[model samples]
Target chain A: MARADVLPLPQRRAIWRVMARRYAHLPLLAPAVAVSVAVFWACMAVLVVMSVYPFLAAGTPRFTLDAWQRFLVDPFYWGVVGTTLRIGVVVTALSLLIGYPTAYAMSKIRRPGWALACYVVLFAPILVSVVVRTYGWLLLLSQTGAVNYVLRTLGLIGQPIPLIFNTTGIIIAMVHILLPFAVFPILSVVGQLTSDLKEAAMDLGANRWQTFRRVTLPLTLPGVVAAAQIVFTLTISAFVTPFLMGGGKVQILSGLIYRDMEAVNLAFASTVALILLALAMAILAASNVLVRRSYSRAEVLRT
Target chain B: MTLVGADRVEDDVELREVSKRFGPVLAVDRVSLQVRRGEFFSLLGPSGCGKTTTLRIIGGLEYPTAGEVVLRGQVVTDVPPYRRATNMVFQHLALFPHLAVFENIAFGLRLRGLPSDVIARKVDDVLQLVDLPGFGTREIHQLSGGQKQRVAIARALVNEPAVLLLDEPLGALDLKLRLQMQAELKALQHRVGTTFLYVTHDQGEALTMSDRIAVMNQGRIEQVGTSQEIYARPQTRFVAAFIGEANFLEGRIAASAPDGVLVSVDGLQVRVAGDGSLPVGAPVTVSIRPEHVKLGAAAAGAANRWDGRVQDMTFMGAVVRATVALASGIAVVAEIQNDAAVGLAPGDAVVAGWAPQHTVVLAR
Candidate 1:
């Protein structure tokens, strides 16, 4: 009775076959993803080994805490980290403030072609070498350079103030170099926003400022966080701009790492590089969390 | 009681020969129209017909290339939307994603620099008016499409703008939601009695909601009159064909007189009356609505009649449509409702006729 009511063997076999077919894409996907993940984990393992290994001299294989101790105990190393972080934080904040309005103005252009032209101008400096831009800033900010020449002509200053080869020059150079990277992501995010919300708010009796505070600012926050993360991480890791502009007087972690590498202090340099990487990763993670929160909130609003 | 003014100072809108051009495209041609105080007026047209553009010009979102915009008979061409006493409910609704329902509704009041207490009270009153009183705490995403639309209305209305403009506000909704909103919006307009300028491509929406309809085409107003007038006596061929279902008979005028004109299409000749002012031998198109065409008529008050064979019968739940082939071999369709008892089947011989008064005359 049960056999008569049951399905045929071919039908049962076909059902089994369909179940097996569910994972047909697995084999084709296995190699490339597996290899890439393996490569990533392998690289991480090498960095971990180098950081924990002892001995400051390069080309020596030894296990020691000497390098870590030297990094933590030295005030100079701490100063480099502090300066790099300070600059990175300031640059990221300014970029967000400046980026939002530029993006808003760009989005308001009636023609898409003109908007694209604005983007090119905003993004062109990024294509130029950071070293070259830094050199340009170096010449401009020099005591006897164009900056002083202009300032003196305006009678703003009687004597040429210290400008290039200092902390101020390094900050200015770093900002110019990182401004595009900071702006583009935010502009893309803002460009996705429709003017409808702003217009609707204004129509509802909201003033221009109120519309921005209530709608424009909150919606573009995810982009702001993303831009901040990129700017922060990139600024901390920047070696060339600071090296050229800081002129040994203002030292950041990347410059210290460079000096350590040249001195063949491989273990010390590795330790510093590892610390820089970890700090950057932490900042990136925090920024990512902020962005995720805003995005989810936006999703909640959208739904 | 806090007394500001008996009527909100900012509740009026007008456009005087306003024109807007985007490079080569004249989006909204020199369109000049008036919305009476507390009248629900609609600008009706198809896509790219400049209805929305005209509304935007009135809202101060788009500046007219020429002419002036007056609100309450005062020139406000330079006034920004934020400074005007008019609010817009966007086609997309454009509700604030960051704010909850209450905040969105109260945004306008807040912008006027009103005290928080007054804003909260006004928002509450409007939210209740829209039947979403307790749902003020709900986020925009949490609300249904209809609910979002209601909130958008509440936000616009709370500020008590003299004029309220809706730019296809229910266009994004599904059919059921759109119908529900139509009734809701009609009720809302009557309740507030603010000068309302509505833009829509949906003729049904305009007919159902507007006190008056302005039929627009190519940035110019083809006709402006009451919905009934516009529907019944369409001034142009575009209005009749666009506003409702009308079969166009492209023909040449065989005879033209002060009282009437005979239009010959293919081999069938139709006498079009009440058509304004035409010369003899001029080309003209005659338009007749399907329902208005008489089938097997005895006394439909029709002055003209034609004998033809029934070629096809289409069942439309409320009405049955039959196509009749005249001796001239030209087919004309006549619609009779199921309840109207169109008993004739295909291949049956019948006489199709219509009244001269019901017949409208239009140009090519």
Candidate 2:
């Protein structure tokens, strides 16, 4: 855009280099983009094709609506969808209720060393394998496990409660495994909030609870929305924890997909996987709107 | 602490022997002051001088480690900020970023469970008072800096507080805007008629805006008085140095003159107008303003006259400053109106002197 004829050779070269640096991220991102296209999008296309046209039991591949009809017309399959969404909503809500306070307290830690210790305690479980953490949960939540034993010793229950192989076990494990995702996003947003906003609210005659409700909660809603998006989608699509904890009792969408895949029903498995993807995408899109609204409202520009 | 002055109904806010300690540092050290009802008072000091800490103590945001705080003839030392009948316009203006301007101003009223119509009416009234009547629907981030400042002020003033605490609310503005806001705030205070306890490090701002100022230094009140009193008759050396530019001449009392005291500075005797309380030979520092120093023929009737040579001259817009070296080899600056003199350059001989009343003698 500059007058190139008036510039010297080295200056022109420098300008060209600056222009080249503007798009430097394209080459840097090429490898990841290529890998995702080949392994994710390409596989997704193959799965879409397999769901509608399949060679099953030595029959030639043909386009048919059998898998779609079987999935859509069946009430049992619809129940699996219901269970998946119900667990997702319930787990997301409980995680928020528990994670919000934890994140707020963590953000309020004044000392670097203590805050670091809290971060380590909160996130160290994520480094361990999900299967291992779920197994640990099973050990803790079994009928004769430490949880029931503690309840028995406290005289709260006369008999060991049925704590595993049900919806309750799946939910408990899912909340535990997905907690860091919830707390991480919320903490990131809450920590960015300045204390002066709350003080301003109080100085304007709002009491402590009023200050939290009117100022603190609204300003930190973006983080809460992001946390919900993550935890909700993760809870819905999660397989290992629910599978191991539910012990074939809870029939979630992921479990259905795994069952069809194990029975060599490629068409049905592909259909279930696409549905799970669509559910996650829909929730993400909805929360993305929420996040945008919250972000715009809470946009603090320093002058 | 005894709340003996609760019967003094004229005082809007009082800090009696109040102190604040942050960890090991004493941020406010036994500071005691009172804000008269319906007066614009300011605590002026440098950063880290604890002026803000004292303001916060009065607002009930920070409790004093000792002593008591009285507000409108009531001992409110234990009252929290929300329970106290006071509001603060914070330094950064701390407008609620999530709320529209209307909601931001309506926050306190809404918390009190006022009806929606009443709240809306009150918010509109305050917005009109701050000169932003129709800006209720605008978000905070969309407003300019000056608009936000008005919103912050309106938010506090809408509560009709007994005393308004302001912590350098204009510190974020540019110089031109700061001056404009300073005049606007002074006018607003007059119109509202609320007792304001303002804190700032700017002496000029305090002098131009406050009815009285408490000059602070090193976490202590150096002096508190009217602007003219504090400027012309500072009770401490720190106040003398901090308020304005002054030439300090360290000396000892040579003798007590008939109406003042004569101090010997570098073998020259300078007469300073005062009570003559200090005994002879007591060490002191004599401060004289450059503008008060007369030059040329104007020095003929001055009480302390000296013959000096101009060493340097700086031409300011309206005033010219001439650094004059006296016969005793001491340099004193004399500021002259550029229009009042002619042809006085560097290295020229001149008579520099000031009246005895113009010299302030501080005990060393």
Which prediction has the highest TM-score against the true structure? 2
Candidate 2 Cα deviation (angstroms), residue B12: 0.6
Runs in model 2 with CA error above 4 Å? A1-24, A56-59, A290-295, A299-303, B1-7
Provide the global lDDT of candidate 2 against the true structure.
Answer: 0.91
Compared with the true structure, what per-residue lDDT tens digits does model 2 show for residues B200-282?
99999999999999999878999999999999998888999899989899999999898999999999999988699899999
Please identify model 1 stretches exceeding 4 Å from their true place. A1-53, A56-77, A97-129, A153-155, A207-209, A261-271, A286-295, A299-303, B1-12, B247-287, B297-301, B325-331, B339-343
* Docking quality (DockQ) for each candidate: 0.56, 0.70
lDDT of 1 by residue, B1-364 (tens): 1233424234355577788999999988888777778889999999999988888888889888998887875677888888887888888888888788888887777767889888888888998889897988887788888898999888888888878888999889999989988998899888877778899999999999999999999999999999889988887999998988876777887886467777778876677776446776678777778888878755255766888888998998888888888787777778887755456888888888876666777877
Candidate 2, B-chain TM: 0.97
Colliding residue pairs in candidate 1: A54-A64, A303-B141, B10-B162, B11-B162, B12-B162
* Top-DockQ structure, candidate number: 2
